[model samples]
Target chain A: MLDSESPTKSPMKTGESATRATTRDRLAAASLWLPVVILSVTATLWSRRLPAELPVEWLGNEGGAFRSTAVFSGITGTFALFAAVAGIIALAGVAATIRPWLVLVAGMVGGSATAAWLVAAGFGLAGEPMPASAVPWMVALVLAAASYGVVPYLLSSRQRRVRLGDAAAGVPLGVGEAGAWFTTIRVRVFGVFAAVSTLAAAVIAVLLVPRDAVGASAAIVALLLVAAGFLVFSRLRVSVDHRGLRVVSSLFRFPIAHVELNRIVSARSAELRAAEWGGWGYRVMPGRTAIVVSGRRGILVERDNGTHFAVTVPNPDLPVALLTTLVSR
Target chain B: MLYKVDPASAVTIADQLAVQVRVAVADGSLAPGTRLPPARELANALSINMHTVLRAYAQLRDDGILEMRQGRGASVRADAAAGTVRLVELADALLAEARKLGVGIPDVLILIQKRGTHA
Candidate 1:
C-alpha cells in the first residue's frame, strides 16, 4: 500500500528569485525550434517556386514595386514582432497540456512569412531556378515544425503503474544516471530514428522532387505526408525507460528531468487537495516552477526550477531516487 | 529556546530527532501509544526537511521506540520504557564525564537538572 504522509517539503519555494532563470531557459529551448521551422518553410516555398509551369511575371522598375517590397517586408515584420511576443507568452505556458500551440503559431507565421519573402525578393528578381542549398534548409524547417508537434505527444506517456517486465533489468546504477541514460537501447533507438527521419526528409526534398510539375503539387504533398509520417512514427515510439529513468522519444535522449538525491532538499509523495500546487506539467508548488508534474498521486522535489526534472515514468519514486543520486553526486 | 545545531555536525537529522523523542519517552512526558506529530508538522516546527523526521521515525521504529501506521500517524511504542533505560544510562555517563572533568558536582547536577526540564 502507498504511504499517505505529506512526504518532505523542499526548502526551495516558488518565489521572485527564479523568474530570471525560468525566462532564460525558456528562451533557449524555444529558440532551437525557430531556426528549424524557418529552414523547412523556406524549403517548401522554394519547392513551389521551383516548378517550371507556374506563370512568372516581372513587376516593372517604373513603378515603386521596390516600395511594395518594403511594405511587404514591414507587414511581415509586424507579424514576426507579434509572434516573438506570443512566443514569450507560450513559454510561460510550458506546463500546460496544449502549450505547444504557442510554438505552432509562432513557427507557422514566422516560417510562411520568411518563405514568401525569400521567393519574392531573391528568386523572383533573379528569375533563376531555386538554389540547390535552399532545398535542404526548407526540408529542415518542415521537419523541425513537425518535430515540435511530435515532442509533447511522446513526452506525455501513459501514466499507469509500471509493469513487472518494464523495469530496468540489470543495468547498473554505477554508470551513474547519465551513463544509465546513454546505455538504454530504447533511448538510443529513438535518437537514431529522429536522425534518420531528418536525413530522409532532406534527401527527398533535394533529390526526389523534380524541378518541374509533371505532378509537382502531388509530389510536394507526398513529401509533406512522408515528413508527417516520420513525425508521428517518432512520437508513437517515445517511452520512458523507468529503470533507466531517462526521457526516450524519437530524436530526444537528453535528461530533461531527474532529482539529484543530495541536491533534493525534500521528497514528497502526496495526493494534492486543490490545485494547491497548480495544474500539471512543470509548475511551482509553493516554490520554484523548475520541474513540477501534477498526476493522480506523484512525487514532488524541492529544488530550483532547473534543478528538479519531471517525466511520466512508472514507479515515480525510482526516477526520484535516480534523480537524487544524480544531484547528490 | 534557541539551541543552534552545528551546520557541520556529523549528526544526521534522524539522530537529532531520536534524541528528542527518546528524551520525551524517558521522562514519561509522551506516554506509550501517544501519537507524535506527523513528519510534515514536526519538520515545519523544527524548520527542517520532512525526510529528516521520517528518517528519525524509521530509525526509532527499527529501534523499537516508535510505531507508525498508515493514516493513523506515528506513536510511542509500548517498548519505549526499555528505550528509556538506554537514555537514562547515557545521561548518567555524560554526567559522570562532567564530574571527571573537574566540574563541581553541584554544577553537573544543575546542568542535568536544567536539561531534564527541557526534556
Candidate 2:
C-alpha cells in the first residue's frame, strides 16, 4: 500500500525543467514535418534515378502468376502512400481535438504500411525480386508501434495504487465514524455490444479466411480486438475510505485513480457532458483527465499537484463529502 | 473527509449532515474560507431531497459558521472558529438545562427571547 502522506507535489528543478522543455520543443518540431521532409527527399532522389516504366509481378494463391508493365515507376505509388501517412501524422499532432489513441492507432497502421511499401520499392529499385510475402514484416512493425504507444499508458496508470486489503481493513463501523462506501457501475449496454460485435467479427474472420498464414494473421487481429473491447467496456468500481478515494475496474481490478486523502486539495460535484469531454471513456486533455461513463453528474477532484480529474457517476456527493472530511482530518 | 447519513437513524438526514459539517469545522478539518460542496450534488449522492441539503446549509449559514453567496456557493467564515466553539458550548449547556428542567425546545426559545428583550 502507498503511504497516504507521501509527497504529491512534483516541482521540477530549474535544470530539469529546462531540459524537459528543450526535449518537448524538439519533439514538437519533429512531429510537425520530419516524416514529410524525409519522404519528400527520398521521393525526389528516387524519381530521378528510376525508369518511367517498370515490370510488376503478381503471384496468385492458386499457382498462377502474371506480369504487367506500369506506366509510372513503382516508387511513385510507394512515395504517395508515405506522403499521405506523414501528412496525417502532422495534422493529428497539430489538431487539439484528435485523441492520443487515434493518433497512436493511425501511427501504428500508417507507419507499418509505409515501411512495408518502402521496403518493397527498395527491392524493386535494386533489381532484386520482391519477397513473396510482406505480411509478417508489416505485422511485426505494427505490433512494435502499438506496444510503443500502449506500454507507457499502462505503466503510468499502474502507478496509482489500489490496496483492496488495506482499504477493506480501514472501514470498521463505530459510533460517529464513517465506514467505507463501495459501489460498482457496470456499463452493461456498451460492454455487451462491444463484446458481441468483436466476437462475431472474430468468428466471421476465422470462417471466411483461407487456412493460410494471412488467414491466421487476420484471426489473431480479430481476437485482439475482442480482448480490447472487453477491457474497454468493463465495470467501474469506486471505493472511499480513510485512506482516500479508489476507482478500479471490476473485471481486472486495475487502478484508475487512487487519490490519497492528503493529496486531495478539494472535491466537488460537477455536471459532465460527453460533448464537452469529446465523447470519452478516458479523456486526456490539456490540463485535465477524465473518466466518463453515462451520467452527467460527476465528481471533480483537484490534487495538490494542481492536476484535475473528473469521474462521471450517478452519485458524486458522498465521495465529495468523504474526501472533504478526510482532507479536513 | 468522511460524512455519513443513516436514513434509518432517529436523527433527520439534514441534521446529520449539519452535525458532520459543524464537527468538521470545530475540529479544524474544514479551514476558514474553505468552500463546501453544492447542495444539489450532495443531495444526489446521499439519495436525499435537495431541500434537505439546502436546509442544512441554511442552518450553518444562520449560525455564522458558513457564508453563502449568490454564485460562489458556501464557505466557512473567516472567524468561524471562535464562533463555532462558542456555539457548541452554548448548545451543550442549553440542551443539558432543557433536559434537566423537562422543558421543550420551543419553551426554551421563548424564555431566551423574553429574557433578551428585558435585558
Candidate 3:
C-alpha cells in the first residue's frame, strides 16, 4: 500500500506553533461575522419601530398587509445576503495556506460590501435613507467578528497528518491519518449553520406569508429553502484518513472512498446531479465525468477496469502537487 | 562547492533541494552541520516562490534529514548518512571508462584513492 519506509512526521515544536498561529489567524478572520449576525437579528426585530423615528419619513403606507409582507420578504432577502457573504468570508479565510492578514483583508472587503448592500436594500424597501455614519461602523464590526470566528476554526481544523497508501485501481484516493477532531468540529459547525438558516427560512414562510397567495408563497419559499439547504451543504467538509475518506454530513455518515491514486485519470469540477451520481451530497464523477460534489475543482480517477472516482476539493493545486509527487514516486 | 540548478525542471524547488541535499550528503560533499543559505535567499537565488522553499525545508525537517531554526537558517542533520541508493549505472559507466583507457582495475582504484586523499 505504501513505500517500505515509514512515513515522515512533522516536527512537534514547529508544528504546534504553526497550528496555533494558524488557528489564531482564522479566529481573527471569522470574528468579522459576529457584527453581521447581530445587526441582522437586531434590524429584523426592531426595524418596524425604529423606522418611525428616522429623520426621513417612511413612504407609502400601502396598508398593513403590504407593509408586513414586504418587510418580511426584505428581511429574508437580507438574511440570505448576509449568510452568503459570511460563507464567502469564512471560506476565503481558510481556502489555502494564505497569510492571515491577506485573508483578513479579503473578508473585510467582501463581508462589508455585501452587508452594506443588504442594509441599503432594506432602507430602500422601507422608504428611508440609511444612516451614513452608522453603516460603516456596523460593517467594520461585522468584519472583526468574522475574523475572530473564522481564524480559530481554520487553526483548529487544519489538517495535521496524512496516511499514504495505494488506492484500488482506477480510484483517486487520499488518506490522512490524524486531525479527525478538527474535521469533526468543522462539520458540526456547518451543520448548525445549515439547520439554522433552513429553519429561519421555514419559520418566516409559515408565519408571515399571506393567506390568499398560499400557493405562490409556497413555491417561492420552497425555492428559497432549497437554495438555503444547498448553501449549507456546499460548505460541508471531511478529511482523508488512512482507513479512507471520512464523510461527515448533518444527515448521515460514511467513508466516501478508499481508492488508489494510480487509477485516477483526470479530476475536474461540475454542477450537482442527482440521478446519475446519487443526488448532490458529494458524488464521485460517474461514467466518463468525474464530478466533484461542491468544490470548484475535483480529482478524477479512471481505473483500467472502467470504474471511476472523483472528489470535490478546495485547493486543487496543493492536492494536485501531492498527487503528482506520489504518482511519480 | 556551488552546483547549478536547472531553471525549468519539472521538480518543485523543495523537491529539487531534497534531491540535491540527499545526493550531496550521500557523496560527503556537504558535511553535517554545514550551514546552508536562508530559505528566503535560496528562494531568491533560484527565482522560485518562497513557499516552495519553506515546504521543502518542512519536508526535510519532517524526514529528520535537515534542521531549521527561525533565524539560524538550515543545516544538515546529524543522522542523515545511513540511507543511500547504490547506482549500478554509474559503477558500470566508470568500469567501462577505465577499460577504454587501458587502465587496470588496481590503477583505477589507486587514482580514486589519490583524489579522495587530496580532497
True contacts kept of each: 0.00, 0.07, 0.00
Off by over 4 Å in 3: A1-212, A216-228, A245-247, A250-297, A314-329, B1-119
**Top-scoring candidate (DockQ):** 2
Worst 10 residues of 1 chain B by lDDT: B1-10
The TM-score-based order of candidates, best leading, equals 2, 1, 3
lDDT of 2 by residue, A42-92 (tens): 556776555433323422212222121132223434543453454344333
By lDDT, the best candidate is 2
| Candidate 2 wrong stretches, greater than 4 Å | A1-32, A37-45, A48-119, A130-186, A194-243, A248-290, A295-297, A300-310, A315-318, B1-119
Clashing pairs in 2: A322-B1, A325-B1, A326-B1, A328-B29
Candidates ranked, most accurate by lDDT first = 2, 3, 1
Per-residue lDDT for A180 in model 3?
12
lDDT of 2 at A104: 44
Best by TM-score: 2
Error of 2 at A68 (Å): 7.8
DockQ of each: 0.01, 0.06, 0.01
Superposition-based RMSD of candidate 3 using all C-alpha atoms, in angstroms: 22.4
Question: What are the clash counts of all predictions, listed in order?
Answer: 19, 4, 43
lDDT of 1 at B24: 60
Docking class of 1: incorrect
| Ranking 1 against 2 by TM-score, winner | 2
